[model samples]
Target: MYLYFEFAKPKMKKKPNKNTHKIHNYEYYTSGRYIDYISRPSAVYIQNDNENRTTLLAEMDSKKLNVNLFMKSKLLINQLSEKHIDGYGFKEESKKLEGKTGLHKLFEKNLIDIDPKEAKEEFKKLENNNQFIWEITLNPGQLGIDNQMVDKNEWNEILNKHMKSLLKANKLDPNKIEGYWALHSNSKYPHIHLGFFEKETNHSNNYRQSGKFSSKSVERFKYLFENSIKTQAEYQNLFSLKNSIWNNRKEIKELFLSTIALKNKQETKSYEALSANELKILNASKVIANFYKNSKSKSYAAAKNNLEVKEAINDIYEAIVENNQKLALAVTKYKQEFESINKAKFSDKYSAGLKDEFVANEKDEFEKQIGNIIVKQCLKMNAKEKEVQTSLNYQEKDLKQDFNDDELPIGLSFYPYKYDEISKLKRMIRSLNYEFNRLSRSQKFQALRKYKKNISGVKSKVIL
Candidate 1:
């Protein structure tokens, strides 16, 4: 699943000098929900700092992660890959049992597929539910433009107006389907995640509605949702700049692996008994790293392309990779940086300072391994892409093709700066998402075994 993270951080700013009575200009970091973690408990699932992770782990239970949906999907997909699932593709399989109790029954007949819990299922059963799920998040210590202290209640009202407008413009029926909005007041932003349900089937599993769901249909929903995001009054400010998204499963999988590697490194570097402040830094860093990785993978095909920012991010990333020296320099720079940031005397700087101070700290070869590691990891693209790029570079030097129209450049370079800020946010969000999913999908579940028949690494036993 594609994950989203916040790339921007709020910096110190002055409100219009009304009576010259000013408030504290605080710097803050933020994050967004990952696609997979939709079912995970929102409170802790969205939390990223190590201190909170430790605190939440102590305060929460294993039951809270609720990753059964993810587990079942994995197992079923693996099983079908090995054997043609009921000798039918997913579309035909669904068509076969169109009128009957299809979803849970299909799971029973051909390994189970998970239906999300009561709340999500109930929410989805509403008429045009997918079209009306009003989701918005806020950053910590943020406020509205003096519209009478816009706390969660006030935010709810603002969102309500937008929802009503959307419902009207789209010719939605409020009478037929009951809609409700709930504020997740306990969260950092204390934001809202609302859903409207068809009053008729809101109480039960509506299999027929799900019968209409498919990957292609979901893509359509995504297209509509994105357009709605841009036009919706409440969301316009929040999603003013369209965030980057990765569509291909293979590319997304590589991004997941890359995130895992970065998270491991951050955890290793983190000190014992991390304070909330320190943990927040960790969270911010991970999010920045994540945005950089995901935004760079888009092909030229998607209409929602963010190529300008993508290329800029790539150039910064390439400065570290594509060579042994540049990568090593960055690693060494950050190593000294890791120690320096903790010092009490050093003035606090934002991301640019954070990165510049990193590179400014060193000259010795003896302390450059960490820089090399970071640089090397930066180029971890898909194998096929890497091979193609490498071959193209070699061919460029080996044989010159001279027609102006037919000329091709060696390969695109990488950049780390444009979105490194966002990658930090993505890292923390992914870490929380992964940890939560892992907790719920652990091997002990009975449903897991029903599905593991598909994923177990079995060989053909070809006797050579």
Candidate 2:
């Protein structure tokens, strides 16, 4: 069992808090294992350390923190609305609850029907000076169960069952916590929102507060709610569907890259082993390859069948292994066809710098020219002898004399120490090299291509 409420162990000769003897228990499922989590003694203060918090969160991640479902749980304090009660009461806001079930108005008891206008008064009476509201939202598609599979009635049943246990863990009974809850199907994803006022300790006294919750209480409630989603085969199927849709473009790119490597006779055991990411990509790539083969007759029969794409990809790979030129050409041609399709399939943020086509080609040409120029420049510079210092002190004296003399060019001349000369020459050469490399391939090609443009006549400057 996991411990939701933690404690700092007592030190030597130190007595534990008497209140620590009591234990709080709750049930939740984690990593496919059903667990009954218990709380530490109430008197034991929780230790809050940044490093420890990070470590705990990482461990929670390993446990699949959300139980494969998404839950948004929060506490809202001092947010009162007359419309909130009216909406729950199915007033003009009845349209919001039209087809949804589990939508109802809550009361303090079986009596005292709190109207929309009296919501603030009733909430203030319960909360007194420390006023707040609590909210919980359970999202669908997070659980393996399809949102459509569960009808409105079944959805309400699930929410009520989970809500009871959640409130019980926090020392509040669902019957006692005056709140409004409704299941909303109008959203893209089905979810239920529960709103409630904080309960005060002494009902007769306004100053006394009770039924408050700790951060741990909130966490336990979340865990209890997530585990309520029953695991089924449909969950796994839904997960696969979501994964494929999310990684569609990514898989395509990886598959294409892998196919290219195999075509060039490169070692690809790493790709062959196929990690989860690579496998998805390879599957997409194979689908594209299969589509290429059937494109000749202007018929893409294989594209219509998702299952056949894998087999088709395999056939194309085997052909490439046998050095089939026709198949290679087909695959290459298909890659071009899919370029625009791929761009349209993904967003600009995801597809950024995917291809260097124009900019890249120009940058490559420019950098190559710059490298050649740098080599020639370096050789020319290297041919000259570096100034040698006969005496260290004598060199320093010469530099001081140069600096003192006003006869040197206003900005051109400076004291030339050995290091200064080396740095100056290095900076000039480095700057030229960097500038050339920095130019876009197109820019470099354009600049150097001009020299070649005059090649029909007397060679202007020999093209690098």
Highest-lDDT candidate: 2
**Residue 130 shift from truth in candidate 1, angstroms:** 11
Q: What is the lDDT of candidate 1?
A: 0.33
Misplaced by over 4 Å in model 2 are: 1-102, 106-130, 144-150, 198-216, 231-464
Candidate no. 1 TM-score: 0.18
TM-scores of the models, in the order given: 0.18, 0.24
| Candidate 1 lDDT by residue in tens digits, 1-464 | 11111111124243522221322121111111211123233321122112222243233334343222212222222323334456557666445323321011110122222233433444433323222222223322232211112222233344444444444444444444443333232332333333343344333433113212234533443344333322332332212111111112223234434543654455333333555443443333332334445554332222012222223233333332333353444444443444443242322234334434433432222123222333234434333346866887776655443323234233322222222435555556757754664445343344644555687774221100
Number of clashing residue pairs, candidate 2: 6
- List residue ranges in candidate 1 displaced over 4 A: 1-118, 124-141, 145-151, 185-188, 197-464
The clash numbers for all candidates, in the given order, read: 37, 6
